[model samples]
Target: MKNEQIVLAQRPEGLPGDETFRYEDTEIKKPDNDEVLIESVYISVDPYMRGRMNDTKSYSKPFEIDEPLNGHVVGKIVESNHENFSEGDVVTGGLPWKKFNTVSSDAVNKVPSTEVPLHLYLSTLGMPGHTAYGGLLEIGKPEEGETVVVSAASGAVGSVVGQIAKIKGAKVVGIAGGDEKVNYLTETLGFDEGIDYKKDNFSEKLAEAVPDGIDVYFENVGGPISDEVFNHLNTFARVPVCGAISSYNSKEDNGPRVQQKLIKSQALMQGFLVAQFQDNAKNASEQLAKWVQEGKIKSEVTIAEGFDQLPEAFRNLFTGDNFGKQVVKVSNSLD
Candidate 1:
């Protein structure tokens, strides 16, 4: 089989342009022992993936120039020599950006498709959902009737965070870029209030939304929005820095540079990866799946059809053009 892959053409200096990525074609090798040959179905495009576009090293290694950029993907196994997998099994994992992948069995998880749709494995039932769960419960530590705010509240992780906060009995407020997303947050996701960060009176509006002050701040996008939220934090508030997406492409990352607020409010600020709380991540996914099944939590997905749209789908995440979880639908049928 011939595989088409999206590669990192060069390290991005700031916001990635069209020149940042290039496409290449290669022949798909057959699965070796303990390996599986899978055809891509759903390709996840995320904000954190932008951080990997730079040459700098952080918790996750940078994507190499001229190499395939990999992220979470749901695929159907066509061939397998592994003990745990078989032909025609659906699975999800961190896979290379390609039409077909021959991968080690240990890297992929067999997805049981009795309940949710296959694409949910790339969104609400996947990594982004897990990130929201672990980050909010473990680091943010929200309590009943407390005010909780989530940035980028219309995006995948942020949307889940706000909904979960509401589930926990906290008064949830969402900070989004536009009025459409603000409406989605308030009407669809059931957030108590939604603030449009694009407005000139954003800080004042956020202040009005959270009159009691913020007890838990689920930090997704970090920039002017974060700086404004910091000013309204209550004493002993918790801040979970899940993703600094706003600063991902920039070389200098001064995350929420409001030192005085931190010092005065005695707020607890911690940055965490979902892997830090493995059990929580597992519980989060399971709970999110159940909540989605129960109609208690809404799962939103924005897919750019076909593998050919991968590059543009990814760049749209940085530009805030995608409303919910961004993924590419590689196949018309998962079967």
Candidate 2:
């Protein structure tokens, strides 16, 4: 049967535009022995995809021009030749942006229960959620009553990081782009304080929010926000650098220089790519899932309909136009 796919039309010069990708139809053969055929239900659009658009060296290889773009997908097995996966079983895995995928049975993990929406597996129970859990606990090591700040606090990873910090008894503050996002962070997400970086008095607001000084900075949006947070960090503060969405669309690689602050405060600043902690995902997922079940954490997702909206949904992440995990629903099983 034929499937629709989005291909990397060209390597983006800086930020990707419409010309960078092309949507086309292709045919896929039935599953081979020990393989499964999947129909995608939802696909994730993430900030890290921007880095993959450039033909530069990174922890993950860049998507080659003319190749189908791949990311986390939640799908249902329509055909299976493997013992592990059965037809009609819902699963989650890495798959290209397409209507269907032919993959090895081992590549798909069965969804635990239908009680939780399948789309949740593509966000809170998926790579982005695990990144927040492991990156914060392992790298940030936040303590009770300590002050913690996170940029892009309304986005996927940042939102989860802040909620988890609060669960751990920290005074959590979030930095976001607009008033709507700031409101969601403070009112919905249970953050102690929310600062709108777009405001003229952002730096002053941040200083007021973090009165005790930041003990942990779970940095997602870098550039000036990170610089200002760095300056406010107390001695021995920990900075878990997860992503830099603020600079994803920039032509130049300029960010706030805070080396002196790091030196003076004796803070620990470390960057981490989630893939590096694949071995710990299982443990982290269990913990995060438990927290969700116990009402200790909450997650939000911004969903767009159809696979055709993939490009626009992805662009929204870099533009700071989306709140929480940006996802595209490919099909309506309930309908």
Candidate 3:
């Protein structure tokens, strides 16, 4: 049978442009011993993919030129050579960007028949969820009555971080790119206040939003917003660096100096990779599933239809065009 996929045609210099990717169709053999043939249902589009486009050193190796990009994908088993998995079992795993994948049985994790949708496995109950859980709890360690702030507050990780803070009894503030995202953060996500970074008085507005001074700043969209937030951090504040989506596409490094604040405030700042807490993912997933069931954590997914929309869907992350976890629906079971 034939499978269509998106491959990295060239290493991007700064931000990835359309020229960096190519779509191709090729033939694949049926599943062999201990393998399963999966028809992809949904694929994730995340800011971390931007780092993979560069040939520099990172947590994961850069994608080889001319190879298919890989990310979290949810699919159903159409053919199986293992006893544990059967036809029609929905699964999630790190799969190549393709219409179908032939993977070893050990490569994928079986999804439970929960009330949460399968797409949640690639978003809220998946890596981004764990990123928020481990980073905030382990690093930020926000306490009740403390002020907690997060950037990219409308995004998958930041949205979850803010809500988790609120659940912990902390006053939560959010910062997003535009008014729409700001509204979503304050209104839908239950943040106490939301700041639009696009506003002319962003720094001033951020100051006004957090009157008590930030006790914990969950850093996601770094750059100028991060710089402004740093200045308002209270003494002995904690900053957990999860991601920096705002600077992912920057041609050059730029941000306000924060060394003085770091010294005076005696604050703790740490950057973490999610894989470092792999030992806790299973436990975290279970807890997140419980939260979802109880309506404590709400997931927002922006789905683009078809495999052909992958490139545009990915590009949307850099422009703040996506409202939440951006996913591409490759093939629908409902259809």
Candidate 4:
């Protein structure tokens, strides 16, 4: 069998394009001892991966030029040389963007069996969901009845953050780009208010949305939207900087200078990686799954069909084309 893999042709100068990726077909490798051959089913595409594409010192290692781009993959074991796993077992973990991956058993884990849909394991019950729960509860520390404003509110992390805040008795205001996303937040997710940041008078509209000022600001996208949010900060607001997708593509740091606002409000601001709260992963997944089952929380995955669509779908992340968690469906033979 031949494995088709997508490799980074070159480091992106700005927003990644077709020129940045290349597809290669190579012979599939047989698993050795302590290894398994995974038939990839689904792969996650995230905004954070954009940082990894850059040749810079960051949280994750930069993608090597001419090598296959790697990410979170949900696959099924086709062959296992390890004692722990067997053929036909569904699992998920860090895997290469290839049809077949021969990886060590330690690099993957069996998917948590649940009545909850399997694809969600790569979305809401996965990194993005945990990122929201950990960043908001731990850093933002939202209190009851206080206003929580989330930038990029329709995104994977921000959407979960908004819903969780509502569950905790806080009024949630979500900032998204369009009216479609704005409606999704208020109508579907139960957010108290939705702000369309692309509006002609966005700053004015945002100011009107959060009359009491922002008590908890889940900072997902950082730019003019956040600059406006900063102006409405309460005396001691909590800001959880989960991501800055707004500036990930730029070599220049165009991030808004919120130092004056931070000083004036004396608000707490912290940047966090989901792995920092590893101890809470299991619990967080369970809670999110429970909420999902009860219909208290709704999850959406904007799937791009076929492995070939991966590059185009990946580009869609920066374009704000996807509504929620974005994943590429590589195969449909789950049975």
On lDDT, the candidate that comes out on top is 4
Q: What is the C-alpha local distance difference test score of each model?
A: 0.88, 0.87, 0.89, 0.89
Instruction: Name the 10 consecutive residues with the lowest summed lDDT in model 3.
Output: 109-118
Per-residue lDDT over 1-335 for candidate 2, one digit per residue giving the tens place of the 0 to 100 score:
77889999998876678999999999986889999999998899888888988888987899988999999988888999999887888898888888999989998899777767667787778888888888889999899999999998988888899999998999999999888999999899999999999999999999999888999999898888787888798999999999988888788867667788888889998999888888988888788788888877787888999989999999888877777889999988533
- Candidate 3, residue 331: the lDDT equals 97
TM-score of 1: 0.96
Return whichever of 1 and 3 wins on TM-score. 3
Worst 10 residues of 2 by lDDT: 111-120
Per-residue lDDT of candidate 3, residues 1-335 (tens digit)? 88898999998876677898999998675899999999899999888998988888988998888899999998989999999999988899999998999999999988875456878888889889999999998899999999999988888899999988988999999988888889888778889999888989998888898888999999998887788899888999999998888788887767777788989999999999899889988888888888888888987889999998998999998888898889999998624
Candidate 2 lDDT score relative to the true structure: 0.87
TM-score of every model versus the real structure: 0.96, 0.97, 0.97, 0.98
Position 110, candidate 3: lDDT: 89
Best by TM-score: 4
Model 3 stretches astray by more than 4 angstroms: none
**What tens digits encode model 4's per-residue C-alpha lDDT throughout 164-226?**
999999999999989999999999999989989888989888888888889999999887778
